[model samples]
Target: MSFATPLYLCGPLREPRQMLADQQYSGHTSIHDDSMAEKLGFRAGPIEGPTHFSLFVPLLAEIWGQAWFERGCFSSHFQNMVVEGELVRAFVERPAPGTTRVRAWAEKADGTPVLEASASLGPDDGATLLDERMAKLRAPEKLVILSGLYVGMLGAEDEKVRMDAEQHMGDLYPFSLAQKLEGITENSPWYSDAASTPWGRAVIPLEMVSVLAEYTSKQAAFPVKQPVIGLFADQEIRMIDGPLFVGEDYLIRREIVALSESKRTESYWVRSRIYDASGETLKAEMLLNHATLKHSYADYEAEASA
Candidate 1:
């Protein structure tokens, strides 16, 4: 692919209401749940991190082509959260030719940073943003929510996950793509129409990819018994063999990568590998930092005080 070609000459497109998935799991009112978010001081539950990822698809496809879906890596560190109906836009500051990576970011019209990321097509594309971050991650200390999880802890067994056409996404993601789009603040055709592209089927949006790649997390429960609510502190999705088509089956294996803590929460990193149904060809991967709020776990307070 040529370097100078502009994916969006018109500049960033307005990203509209993206809040959809309701994370009612822990009942503590996470940013994913509207009522919970409002009570927690946010305007409304802020849109999920993975949902913001969809903003970059068109730009990636424009710069990398179909090959990108096979081996592209998008690594990001979330900077801030925006609630439903907030105006934001994705931008790619394309790299000068002969370079392997480019900087990407999203900002509200008022210029608040949303998330900053790096995108590249590779295995040879060099290290992704998450790769570098993971390399520097310090082992977590004095953890309560993620107490038993150690590096390299494996899942109980391999998991096979897929998205059904009827909007059923299985346990990890209770809502389907159709349902998500219903209240979608940003309406994009690329998410629903297969005929819009040369690909025979509709493309799976990153929001769906988030579910497609890790819906079976419970099968590999890492022994963290705390009922504390968890959220993605940071996440990276890397595609190896394809774009991860909709309604296709993929197998995944998870391992605890690292554990770390912040002032208010403790986090565990899980590295999940996605494979085609044949179980041989690797297709995609996700690196997730599941950060649990210490304030939400009563046990954490007791342990800290003791």
Candidate 2:
């Protein structure tokens, strides 16, 4: 694995003075809700993991220039959860010129780690964050959402979806890229103002990229039996050819990579890669671990037993 340029390195990237204040987006029954989050032993609805990805984009942009957004990839493994209002900053070890991949991490004001990852660009012929993790994953013998499913299940066919700035991104993300820019806590004009950067237009923020890239996952036939609410236990988004443009059409295809479980939930991990409109250029990809609460599926025991 090699890079087009040196790995990006600079001083710590500090987020804006705002916190992730969108807990209200999730309904009262969702774990992200205050009461439910507290009941589940969290300090508060831990701010969404995707929200933290914002801190690293500027560093990527600075390192690779506007081209990074076009083709940069940031793959990560989250290490901890932090609440709103917590002060966290991103740091990357400056790589030597021509380095392909480098270590990156986010830490609290006190230096406690939040997430650790490998950030890069282009076709990473080398094993990736998810690829290495998937290689060691073991599926549970019993599952609720994934009972009928097995690893390596591909989508029925290649699914094509596009990002429309005016439309809400289904239930999971009820806001559009235009709407998300309204309260963007990270505070980068490059995300919404075309004049702010050399990309010729405003770019999509990482948080909104979650919606643009993944909102259609619900339409996928993952073999989950019941309609259960799910949360992202882990996620990684990587861009291959170029930065995805706002409101532009992109293509996506999903595949079930692995399955696992925890004491309270069953998990299904899927990898979705985004391509350019022509479907020839590899643009971006996301690996998501969707963990559904066992209790949410009323017949979880029956399904697991079967």
Candidate 3:
């Protein structure tokens, strides 16, 4: 809770897994599938970018204690693909006294950058990495793959989501919170032992915040052309009120806040707001850039020529 910290904090090297080989969406196998990844020019199915978020939690928690979970933010832009078995580590640029924001990142063992990020504690009004990026987005001149999508589009329904220790998260995340704890990069008793937590309830892990928010995302049904491949090009997860708890019910409302394109992909940004079970209290928020690969869309060339 104090700033008498070192210049930086380094975490143990971890090998995050690619558990999405069977991930399906838009009626097709996703980029996390080995065959799909090869067709799209990646060396292999890369680990989901947010998996790296776990490596930084222990370090940040040490710096800010339990508050890091209640009102902390981790904003990141993934820089390189990390296939399974590759070693990666997290680093935080220790903040000076009274500072709330600090730089954070991850890298492969040989020093290849995996992702670059910002970590901060709230009541924060500070701009995150995605906040800056979204601000600079000039409306893409043309969007072929994401043409069906528009900014401010809302999810089809309010989703009620929660993570139970033994419940499998569904196709996109195919594992339970209990299963994740078995191999998590940094394990904490607070994740499973309510008796040991300050909140008196077992809290969900930092990285699993992504899982909790995304658990029922398909209900949102923001219409993007599908059967095409996509990946997490960027992400920001923030806790507003406090730590999200395991087995606790929450409601999520989503909206497409922005859209853009590059030569290889078209991206739609969605912001999911998590509310307490009664749908009244704001608890956490996640901003994500779901970028769809252009070439992977069967109609990209055909539709462009038309």
Model 3 per-residue lDDT tens digits across residues 1-306: 655546889998889877778887767788888988898888888888988999999889888887898899999999999998999999999877678999999999999999999999888648888888889988998888888888888999999999999999988887899988988878889999999999999999878999898889989987777678889999999999979999999999999999988878899999999999999999999999999888888888888778
- Quantify all predictions' global Cα lDDT against the true fold: 0.74, 0.71, 0.89
For residues 1-306, what per-residue lDDT tens digits would candidate 2 score against the true structure?
Answer: 866664545445354322223333224345565666676667776666777777887777666666667666677777777776677888776767676676788888888898887777666526667667767876586676777777788877666777666777665565666676665656577766678777676677776677776676655767776655567777878766656777678878888888998888888888888887778877788888888878776787776677
Backbone clashes (count) for model 2: 4
Q: Please list all clashing residue pairs in model 3, or write none if there are none.
A: 70-242
List runs of model 3 lying over 4 Å from the truth: 1-6
Candidate number of the best lDDT: 3
| Model 1: CA > 4 A from native | 1-15, 18-21, 26-29, 38-43, 170-172, 181-199
Consecutive 10-residue window with the lowest summed lDDT within model 3 = 1-10
For model 1, what is the C-alpha lDDT against the true structure? 0.74
For candidate 3, give the lDDT.
Answer: 0.89
- Per-residue lDDT, model 3, residue 224, is 73
The residue pairs found clashing in candidate 1 are 17-185, 70-240
RMSD of each: 3.4, 4.6, 2.4
